[model samples]
Structures are given as C-alpha cells and as structure tokens.
Target chain A: MHTLIVIDRPPYGSWSGRESLDMAFSLAAFDQPVSLLFVGEGVLWLSQRQDASAIAQKSVERNLKAAAIFGIEALMADQSACQRFGLGDGTLIDGVETVTDLRVTMRRYDHVVFPG
Target chain B: MHTLHIVSKSPGHPRFLECLSMVDTNDVVLLTGNGVVALADSSIEVPSPLYALEGDIQARALTPDSARCQVIGFDDMVALTIQSQRVISW
Candidate 1:
C-alpha cells in the first residue's frame, strides 16, 4: 500500500515531527511505498541547518538524511506553508519537493497517516 | 484486538500510564523521545513486547539492554504498525 505520512509540527520542542518521520521510515522499511508531506510548521523540519547537540537531542537533520537509506525518496513540503513560513526551496535541505496543493497530492496515496 | 501503543513522554507523565493501561497482552509498545529515558529504568513495569527507538536511546544515552526492551529502528516499528489492527499514540 502507498502511504503518505503527514508532518504538521516543527522539529524542535516536540516529538511529533520526528515521530511522524519514524512512522514513515517504518512503513518504508517493510517495502511499503511511502511518501512524506510536511505542512504547517512542519516545513521548518526541512531547514538546511539544525544543530541539536547543545540541546542534548539527536540531530533531526540526521534522521532526515537517513530517509533515502530507507528507500524514501518522495519528500514534499506544502508550497503555501513554505511561503507562509518564509521558507523556500533554497532554504530547505536537498531533495525536498514543494507541492502546490496538498489536498490534491493526498488523494494519490492509499492511506494518509498523521503523527499522533 | 492487538493494538500499537506509542508513548512519547517521560514516565510519570499522565499519558505514560494512560498508554500503558491501554495495552493488552499481545499489543506492542513503542517508546520514543523523552519516554525512552523512562523505559530504561528497571522499576517501571511494561505490559507487552516493548520496543524503544535506537535514535532516542542514543540521544538519551540509555542502554536498551538495561531496560529489557527490544531496541528497534524505524523499520521494525513500521512492521509492528502494519501487524496491528489499531494504533494509539500518547
């Protein structure tokens, strides 16, 4: 089944965003086709530089980089969310695609998962 | 019915017990973030086959073996999610 994991929260101060990616990685590991959609404050997760060491937390950027190893190549961010957050493609990490319409994009997947 | 229970907070957090209470014998419990630290403490009783994320373990510097729960990566968590009929996160 093709699953679209949605991340609507930012990377820091909360575990929702990283946990959502963990769910994506898990689904992709079982050879299930999975994609990631970052919206709302979640667009910030794609920031080019996330130094979490001082906070005594694992670098979320490292986890984001590991997506490819799990065979997850379809990473996307909501275009509107990016603009609202003043983040563009250039400010995000490499390989993140921006989608114009999330509603339209969500319909393509068999299931849409939200990190709880 | 097998359920996948996820706890993302430290122990003593209201949601931790709430998540644990929801688990059945066959359910799978996955601990992440701050919750991983609590899982490492031997005193707390875990109900089912428990798992902790490797990244969270490393981040907290907690030994998975000490906690007596299986240390799993994202892939293992994915497999567990697929096997369960329902999932509840806290």
Candidate 2:
C-alpha cells in the first residue's frame, strides 16, 4: 500500500517526529510505497544543521537524510507552513518538495499516517 | 471522494472537531491514540461511520458503544485505509 506519513510536530520537544520516521522506514522495509510530508510546525524537521546533543537527543537532521536511503523519496513540506515559519527552499534540506495545495497532493496516497 | 479521517486526539481537543468537520456521511472515521476516549465521551458525533483502533481501545480499557461504532484491528485498519479514496489524519 502507498502510505504518506505526515509529521506536524517539531523535533526535540517530543519523540513524535523521530518516531514517525521509524514508522516510515518500517513501511519501506516491508516494500510498501511511502513518503514524508511536513506541515505546520513540522517544517522544522527539514531545517538544516540541527544538533540535538544539547538536549540529550539525537538530531532529527540525520533522519531526514536517511529518508532517501529508505526509498522514501517523496519528502514534502506545505508551502504555507514553510512561509509561516519563514523557511525558504534554500533554508530547507535538499531533496524536499514544497507543495501549494496540500489537500490535493494528499489524495495521491492511499493512506496517511500521523505518529504524533 | 470517500475519505478516511484518522483522529488521534481525545474529545475536547481542537483536532477532534477539525477532523469531524472534514468528514461527511460518505467518509469513514477511525479513532486512534487518545481519540479512543471519544467512544466513552458521547458529546462527540461523527457524520460518517466510526471505528476505533482495537489496540487503543483495549489498552485504555475502553468499552465502546458497539452499536454506534465498531472496533477494528491493525489489519482491518490497513484494509480500511486502502478502501478509502483518500486519508487525512488529525
């Protein structure tokens, strides 16, 4: 099944963001089609150069990088959400797509999973 | 198109209403996470047929109104997800 994992929470505040990646990787491991979509405050998950060592946590920046290796190439961020956080394409990690109509884009997937 | 609305929030949470408002009679609603509390809290009503994750229900020791909503396992959840034309989670 094709699944779209939506992460709406920022990293470090909770384990939800990283946990969502674990689910995505699991789905990909089972050979299911999977993608990652970041909305609202979740856009922060794509921020470059995140270091979580200060908070005694692993950096989610690593998870974002590993997404492509998991065959989850469809990394997306909501256009409005990125703007809300003042994030531009240049500020985000490479290989992320910014979509304007999130509702329309979401229909492409058979299922959407929210780990938060 | 028929949509599957997945609500992960309990009643009184803002996402619960946002999820309810997005679904209509033709859609399906699955209550997961803290959302299973809605089964006991009768104040919330979903326009579409409602189901709660069996795992969550059992974990919370919640006895859902079986007549109003059904309890489904993870396999059934996967089936429902594929059966729906689209899905959105809140």
Candidate 3:
C-alpha cells in the first residue's frame, strides 16, 4: 500500500523525530510505498550540517539517507516552515524535496503516518 | 479497541493544540520532551491513558499497562502522519 509519512521534529533533542523516521524506514524497507514529509523543526534531520551521530545516538541523517536507499522517495520539507525556523532556503539538506504547499501534498497520500 | 495517542510538545505550536482538539480520554496521550514541559500549562486537556516520561516521550520511556495497543515513542509532532487517525503536536 502507498503510505505517506510525515516527520516534523528534530533529532536527539526529543524522541518524536527519530521514532517517526524509524517507522517510515521500517515500512519502506519492507517494500511498502512510503513518502516522508518534513515540516517545522523536522527539517533539521535533512540538514547536511547536522551531526546527530556525534553522541552515538541513532543518527537522523543516517536514517534519512537509508530511507532514500531503501526506496522511500517521498521525503519533503515545508518551505514556510523552514522560513519560520530561520533556516531560510533551508540549507541544502540531502535527500529531501522542499516544497511550498504542505496541505496539497498531504492530500495526495493514501495513508498519512505521522510517525513522530 | 484501545488507541494510545502520544504527544511530545508543549503548547508551543498551534499544531499541538490541534492534536489535542482531535481526541479524548479513551485514547492514551503520552506527553514528553517539550510536551512534558507543556503539561505544566494544565489547559492542554490531554485525553486520558496519558503516558508520559519526564524526558523523551517519543523514546517510549513510560509504558502504559494495556493490551491490544503497544507504546512507541513518537517524535515531537510526527504522530499526525497516520491516516484515519488523530494526533496532538507541539
């Protein structure tokens, strides 16, 4: 089934971001059609500047990269949300498609999994 | 059917309020992180079965004693991604 997963939290600081991504990756790893959207602070996971693994915790960056490798191509970041966080233009985060319209994209999915 | 709803944000964002407005006591609402801090407000109106940790709620620190539904740490506001489901965020 085609599943739409949304992640809008940062890494390590809290648990929502990592947990949600874990679910998304698990689904996609099993060959489920998965798409991930990042909004608010969630965009932090994609930032190339992020160093989540420095502390030995599960790395959001590594998970995102894994999701892409595992065929979870629906990774996206909210444009306005990026602006709100002062990450204007949201530093180029690998494996994420930054878009301006969240609601529209949200409506396109069959199953919306807020894995946060 | 038992449903556990976990939220990890304070009243910091409008989405948190939206997540709260979506459900009630029958479901479990886990508040952690900024969410644990958010609980201090008292007005959050979390529907019961509220399982929260003093820290990372998403990490699934506190487990609710129940069958049918399992407890998992949901990242901040990422719980809203499921279909036909309701969620609370920060």
Q: Largest DockQ belongs to which candidate?
A: 2
Sorted by DockQ (best first), the order is 2, 3, 1
CAPRI quality of model 1? incorrect
lDDT score, candidate 1, position A4: 79
| Candidate 1 local Cα displacement, residue A65, angstroms | 0.9
| CA lDDT for candidate 2 | 0.83
Q: Candidate 3's residue-wise lDDT over A1-116, tens digit each?
A: 57677776566887766678777778877888878887777766666666656787866666677776778866788888777766644465655677986656754655555664
Task: For residues B1-90, write the lDDT of model 2, one tens digit per residue.
Answer: 698898889888765775676566688898889989888887766554888899999999988877888899999999988897877877
lDDT of 3 by residue, B39-88 (tens): 44545444554555534534434433434223344453345234224332
Clashes per prediction? 0, 0, 21
For model 2, residues A1-116, the per-residue Cα lDDT tens digits are 68899888888898777688889998888888999999888899888888888888887888678878878859999999898988885688888899997667777787777776
Docking class of 3: incorrect
Give the Å error, residue B68, model 3: 28
Q: How do the candidates rank by TM-score, highest first? A: 2, 3, 1
After superposing candidate 2, which stretches have Cα over 4 Å from the reference? Answer: B39-45, B51-83, B86-90
Q: What is the TM-score of each candidate against the true structure?
A: 0.56, 0.78, 0.56
